[model samples]
Target: MKHLLFLYLGVVSSFASDTRPLKERVNEFCQKHRSIAEIEKRHAEWIKQEPDNPDAYILPANALAKAAETVNIVAGDQKDAIAVLTDPKTGKQVGSIAEGPDPAIIKRAEDILKAATKKFPQRLDIHVGRMAMSQRIKDTEAVTTAALDLLATAAKDPQTLRWIDNEQIDGVPLKKALEEVEARIRWLYSFEKDETDKFAQDCALKALELAPGNVELLNFAAIRHLYRGEWKEGREYLLRAEIAAPRDWIVQHNIARASAELGDKADALKRLQAVIKAVPGTDDAKAAEASIKSLGLDVPK
Candidate 1:
């Protein structure tokens, strides 16, 4: 999934105008399943040859990161890891062995992209690539710093920022990319890590500074405060999100939640009813009905 996000963002695959040959060679190597070390070497040479092309750095970095993933079978109950395999025939839990990306290789990959950022600080794609790779390794500390740097860069003059394919990356396009990062962070937050949760909220708030009216960011911001029992703050963002996406069912659900939290039973009941009306048979509607019952409000006929 992280790899897919990197591809979607054009981070793992983009070529400078004069570096198409390098890109093709890299693609060919990958298709042939050539050694990742060879691919890394080729990309490293390309990086040296074309020091200013951020894509040169990104390609090798991605290869290294992908090559780092490994799976091994060992003994012991390690339920605290990703990709825990089970013994299907026995229908019992087997010993959990840690199998995932190699930390040392991931660090090397991260370092390459980090250097790219230093050389091309204005390249938004490079920064995004780094962030995606860090998330792949579950390096939330790195992610937090990189995310803040990305937001700071985004808050600068648009003319200074560069994206791959020479596409303009301000306003909606930028917002969409940031939202992708936010989605990944949200996934990390689901583990209930205090640092990851704080980083998620910080990311939403920073992104809102760049596009305060973004419905997704607004919703995220509202959820951050709402989860912390800050009803008023959450409601402030939810109301703005509602204005931006008036028909958004999730937004309506959140508004209902905030209203209920604020002790506005009547308002909450009305919004909950609206949610059910807008999205009948969906999870939101079911949840809305449950909320209605919780609030001791009758279903509207």
Candidate 2:
């Protein structure tokens, strides 16, 4: 009877082990650790055990990102404290602390992501992870390069582009990744003081290449050109956006603005009226009304 009980227990143990998923086990292990070093060690073990698993790479990247966030929080507090201090003698600014994430942590995360990229060249998420970590560290070149890599990868796979456009693929949401890349391009457009608009324009164009006919990206590209006073280029993008989203009043409004800037008052007035007609009682309509007034045209009744 004792021998029979032992055999039953062994069978139950084997059955339970077989039913547990590897990803669940890894997640459970990671959740129990607070230390980045411990998480990294466990993730390394996972990679060793399952070299082909993308999660093995993703888990360590996440752990490193958490570490970087912790460092940034501490640094931000230091910077905030510095901002309130002033010189006692002159009541003027003395010195301010410039703080950011630890360089060592950033470097480690970059190295891991680089390895993951080489190992899983087609994994868009890994490139996204790299882009995010680079943004955290304010590495503009790295962020742009990663964004470009993501665009290139998406271009190679129609399904990937579709996933990004539709916001998810295989249960992973692409919205955040797309937003991050777009935000980086917008930032470059607004704050890249030393560089010409070409770099930001190029990044935006590359993104459009991957997600052609994307209205938001098209609008973004249009705005970048308008901001740089390239009215002709801006008008071209606006026309494309109008084609992509014919009933979108905001696109019509932008088309009006671009036309007005290019000294085409009649075209501008016509588009503003169309915008007001298509989306009455909305903010776009209000803006269209204002533009019509600014263009010395009568508001449509």
Which one is best on lDDT?
1
Candidate 1: list runs displaced more than 4 Å.
1-18, 21-23, 27-50, 77-98, 159-172, 277-283, 298-301
Per-residue lDDT tens digits of candidate 2, residues 224-297?
A: 67777788988898889888889888888777777888778788898887777877898888998887877776
Superposition TM-score, candidate 1 onto the true structure:
0.75
TM-score for candidate 2, residues paired by index: 0.68
Worst ten-residue run, lDDT, model 2?
Answer: 1-10
Deviation from native of the Cα of residue 64 in model 2, angstroms: 2.6
Q: What is the lDDT of residue 153 in candidate 1?
A: 67
Question: lDDT (CA) for every model shown?
Answer: 0.71, 0.62
Give the C-alpha miss distance for residue 19 in model 1, angstroms: 3.8
lDDT over C-alpha atoms for residue 167 of model 2: 26
Deviation from native of the Cα of residue 221 in model 2, angstroms: 1.9
